[model samples]
Target: MKKIFICFALCLLAAFFKPASAQFSTNENIKDQPKWGLAGQKYVEYYYLPDIDTYYYVPGKQFIYQSGGYWTFSSRLSKANRSYDLRGGNKVVINEPGAYRYFAEHKSKYGSSSSNVAVQKSQTDKNIKRQDSEKTSG
Candidate 1:
């Protein structure tokens, strides 16, 4: 009876601190995943354990991913390399896959901070006049 009591106590202790896989047994597929993005609360939590890779929602904290360190915004690149679109909310993607520090930079080439939609209208008036001249000559 004493041996049984001791065994039960040890089992309970192990259950409390064991990893997620040991704690739960389910038929879930979680390997060879591509991109991990934000869910509900905040930024995507890209982390690694012993043998596999996993991701979850962890806001106010950040992690960096290392495998394919670069997240692409260019359409010319392969689809798999694409980064998360940040135009919606305060969004970001880990260029690497571990823990990373982020810096905010704009994609706009215009001198002043202006709406990207207005870029077309801001075309150096020189270009517009050149186009008009070409049309008149032809």
Candidate 2:
């Protein structure tokens, strides 16, 4: 009985004790990110496009936008937004789940006209440049 109990405990520990690297690995999550996602980031769940007030779900590859006071999901943006440059526009990395639920908050924080938007864009740009330099130097 003692040996059996000890074996069971050992098995439980082995199952729950994941390696540190494995626990922190973002490779699997990063695979779902969009092509224009931020470089050197571990993983991103959504990209909030402040300029257009839209959220792009990375895993689902869907755009979440407002239409007639309702949240809509589509693979592409509406005709009105067709002229927007998604790749060139400022993108705020949002890791929160169901980010659209806080649309009002996001808008106030990262909206096109918000002062925070410029600061965030500049910070993001600096990080990207730093990462690029590190990659090249290494």
Best by TM-score: 2
Residue-level error in angstroms, candidate 1, position 108: 3.4
Off by over 4 Å in 2: 1-28, 113-138
For candidate 2, the 10 contiguous residues with the lowest summed lDDT are 129-138
* lDDT digits (tens) for residues 9-99 of candidate 1: 9999988885556666653223322233223212223321111121212332322233476532221223332353322212322222222
Q: Model 1 off-target regions past 4 Å? A: 18-107, 110-138
**lDDT value, residue 68 of candidate 1:** 73
TM-score of 2: 0.62
- lDDT string, candidate 2, 64-105, tens digits: 999999999999986689788776666777666688998898
lDDT winner = 2
Worst 10 residues of 1 by lDDT: 129-138
